[model samples]
Target: MGIRPLAKARTSFAATFGGLPSGFWWLWTAQLINRACGFVMPLLAFYITEELDRSAAFAGTVVAGIGVGSLVAGPFGGALGDRFGHKPTLVAALGATAASMIALAYARSPWALIVGAFVVGVTNNATRPAHNALIADVIPGKDQVRAYSLNFWAINVGYSIAMLSVGLVSFTGYTALFWLNGATTLIGAVMIATRVPGRARPAEPTEAEEAAGGFGAVLRDRSFVAFVGAQFLVLTILLQSESGLPIAMSLDGFSPSTFGQVAALNGIVIVAVQLPLTRLYKRFPESWVLAGSSATVGIGYSVLLLGDSAWIYGVSIVVWTLGEIGNTPTSFALVARISPDHLRGRYQGLYQVAWTGSAVVAPLVGGWVIHTWGAGPLWIGCLVVALAAAVAQLGIGTRLTRRVATKDPEEQPEPAKSAPASDAG
Candidate 1:
């Protein structure tokens, strides 16, 4: 019995993860390294309010600096990646991320810490546009969803490790948190520089293509823009898991260690179910999948109104994590499908802006709500925003279906190559 189940598990693993290109795996490995110690951002609120002895409002402002930086980086990073090369862009950005993290660790003064957070946001986010672009560049479109799903799983796995480590070690201090994060980010940079291939630049755009490309063209995409807006709404709710949720728990008398354990549960649930659900969700329409997932996230967070027990928070995290599992990879795949190859980076960058941009708004609003009113109103508001986002997503789904039905043969994206050229190590 045990032997048969073990064999079945092996087969499932192979079916789920097998056959990606070397470059994709290298990219996956690099991201795993970077995220494995990605504890700082999630816990930055605690560090500021508890360690620095700042107010919740002040922490929100500092955290908002990351959003400000991300908003700036998204479009520019994508444009640079499109104009130059993804490999070089990632190398420079990751190196900067490492330096900025170290700088953030040592910052003591209010102004210094605020500036450090902003710089950390810029360098940390600048890689995302190129990262997603490279995936679209290399992976066959049919495989991009699976690749992204696996990547999401890797992210949660890393988050689980990071959070659990924080629970274990954070009592010592958070200085090591920034240092470890920086070191891992630097290693990821080295991995990219040494192992990933420099993608061959595409043929220069023709007159029509030139007219349609760049940030102007991306902005002109009304459908994509609306989709981004819905994304922003949903992210405003989800990002609270990192920013507002921790502070809420702390105010309710939980320790940072307790918060870390609960936050780690979010990752643990994702690590367990994300891949399997990815396959399951693929069977449904993208729009309905997203709508349902958004609703699920809202319901999950709303559960917080019931109580403040560790068990209640754990349930909240798990329920929302299920929604997150369905939402992230499915949404990314949809974005990839809708985007033109020439504008993949910008599309991804704009997509990233939805999340980072929410970081800007969600924290400021959530902090104020928690400080001024209470956590109750904040959780209530999440449900309202999530329902609105779900409605918007359904409209997007209908439009996407119509767009596909009406698309001309010539309008279809050129088939991507099986794999990108890699630098021989």
Candidate 2:
């Protein structure tokens, strides 16, 4: 609360940035630009209802299209990165995303918009697996945790700026929003294409290697599967911010601008505290931090039941934002740790499936529930989901790191290893 914790955080912050590669900053820059310009998803529900005069159920379906895109793209993207390398995969995905956003922006009909949404999801969402593989390739083992944290920090900083801007732009019209989104995505693509050099893809696995580990390898890893599933449960509720919260706020007579203000609370909180939270979380067991995060996120939504005022919503956002701050970097670091370096892309892609599933299903389920049962029931349902996610996360902790268990950032995997570095930086 005082200068003492802030001072310590500043010290830890310096340590987090020390010794990272130059390429990482470029990656971070692209992330900042892409997210900074990200405008569509946050206000998508409003665009559909207020701008397009669509039903909430139909809006949910459109949002679900994004999830479908991520689901399809995530694994394919990871495989493409595994085979073709990271830089090219990133360039293609980002370029395709720009085109999809442009398509979505111009689509005049509901069916067209729905198809555009799905295309956006496919082209855009795969960026994660490609990105994670690149991080593993460029960064040394010791710095993976902080590297991912810094990358995530870029995402939210841009996200905070984008949300605030989108809130204001909503007053003007949505056309500009789509154009800006596509432009920024194109810019990010250009940066990576021009600046970031490519790494060679991993050699194909031998027959023995294929039998023991390959495409379906991650699927057979029980602990990793559990971790991804727990993530699915929690993301379902957290993603509700994209659609559920907006819908609820509008029903309460709030404007999209007000929704932007409330949602900005999340990005603001993360940007402010991510460094300190990183420092703080480094002190605890990763499992404990992740479990606590799941619990906190649930509690944040339950707070929604208490009131519907702007300040109330803001406080709820801050509460869950803390959970987000802790959960995200920890999960990324853990994914890097548990995943053998050779198959990190596949692992990340598989892990991403949990989030993809949530994005695909959460909005549809939440919207249907809200439509059928109203706001109160939706809040109650979030509380239930939260409990389930927390338990599942806690249970997975006992089995999380069977192959590699070093918690210190100083540790490094041996050289000339097999797929262990497949997830490499």
lDDT of every predicted structure (CA atoms):
0.80, 0.78
lDDT of 1 by residue, 1-425 (tens): 79999998998788688878888888899988788889889889899999889999999889888878889888878877877777778788999999998889889888998999999888889998888777767777556678888888888788666755777444658887788888999998898788777675534677898887898898988988998999888888998987789989999999988897787787778877888787676655667778889988998999999999999999998988888888888778667667766777778889998977887788778888899999999999998889888988877865763464344333332221331112000
lDDT per residue as tens, model 2, 1-425: 69999998777757878777778888889999889889887777778888888899988788778767778888888877776777788888888888888778777687887888888888998888988778877776556767888888998888777755766674758888888888988898888877776576665667776677766888888888888888888888889898688888999999988997788788778878887677666655566667889889989888889988988889889998898888887787778677765577788888788878887678788789889988778888888888778877765753563344444324642222332333221
Tell me each candidate's RMSD, in Å, in order: 6.5, 5.8
**Candidate 2 root-mean-square deviation in Å:** 5.8
Q: In terms of TM-score, how similar is model 1 to the real structure?
A: 0.84
How far out, in Å, is residue 49 in model 2? 8.1
Question: Pairing residues by index, what is the TM-score of model 2?
Answer: 0.82
Give, for candidate 1, the lowest lDDT window spanning 10 residues: 416-425
